[model samples]
Target: MGRWRPPAEKKSKYITATGYKRMNDELKYLWKVKRPEVTQAVKEAAAQGDRSENAEYIYGKKQLREIDRRVRYLSKRLDDITVVDRIPDDQGTVFFGAWVTIADEEDNEQRYRIVGPDEIEASGQLISVDSPLARQLLKKQVGDEVYLQKPDGSEIWYEVIAIEYEPY
Candidate 1:
């Protein structure tokens, strides 16, 4: 088999104000603080005799490449994204940046914030707007039910119990 792979699907460009700020902050830190520090380390390492066997020089160069890659990606993403700073007029409906609380038939509830793909967190509280759950929840008002079919062929339903624009 070849090492070739298909291109990834394009991600949505809508980002909340907080998420945009976070991305910008990361870009700035990587470009301003981190890059200069690594450059200096690499320079010092290069000055010390032979570079072929110099572990510090090789490691520093690798770190520089990774940092530059991230910086470039963040810069382009920031320029392309649209920042959603204001809350929507319809507070009762699920929309971007809204904190939605959903409940299953058993009354088990979970809260999630609809954010851009870049802002999806490991905490599970933030979900990308392009996600299946968020797509079904969009424009849905409180008391509305959302149906989703899992990849495993199981079906589940969730009722929108509450929707808030502000973070809790």
Candidate 2:
């Protein structure tokens, strides 16, 4: 069976100043260090001959392809990104770059930074602003109830505990 998925995530042109800097740094590191290192490895592997049977060659080539793909994606993303350098005037509503705390029906507290899809990372509870949950949370204020209609004919309920634009 195929896995379920939301539509392709679309990111806003505006990113927080810190987010922009992190993306820029990643792109720079990939191009200046990782890209060249992978290219060199691929070349070295190729020089050994018999690439069809060469595991190193195959892996190097695959890694290089993946790196190049990301490099290109970051290039386009950076160009499109606006880099929201200043905070917005809205304080009561949840929007892009907002830090939100919510409690589910189970009384489990969750904190997440709503950010562009390109900025998501596992280290932090970062939710893509374009996600279904984020979409429901957007424009909502503290004390507002949000109900997410899931695919399994069930709904998840959450109440906004706090919504602040400050970056964490």
Return the TM-score for each candidate structure: 0.96, 0.80
Leading candidate by TM-score: 1
Q: Which ten residues in a row are the worst by lDDT in model 2? A: 8-17
lDDT of 2 by residue, 1-168 (tens): 899888974656767788888888998999999989988998998999999999999998898889889989989989988776656688888877888999999899999988877778887689887788888998999999999998998999999999877743
Q: Rate the local accuracy (lDDT) of all candidates.
A: 0.94, 0.86
Q: What is the lDDT of residue 15 in candidate 1?
A: 95
The list of candidate 2 runs beyond 4 A from truth reads: 1-9, 49-53
Error of 2 at 136 (Å): 1.4
User: Which residue pairs does candidate 1 place in steric collision?
Assistant: none
User: If candidate 1 were superposed on the true structure by all CA atoms, what would the RMSD be?
Assistant: 1.7
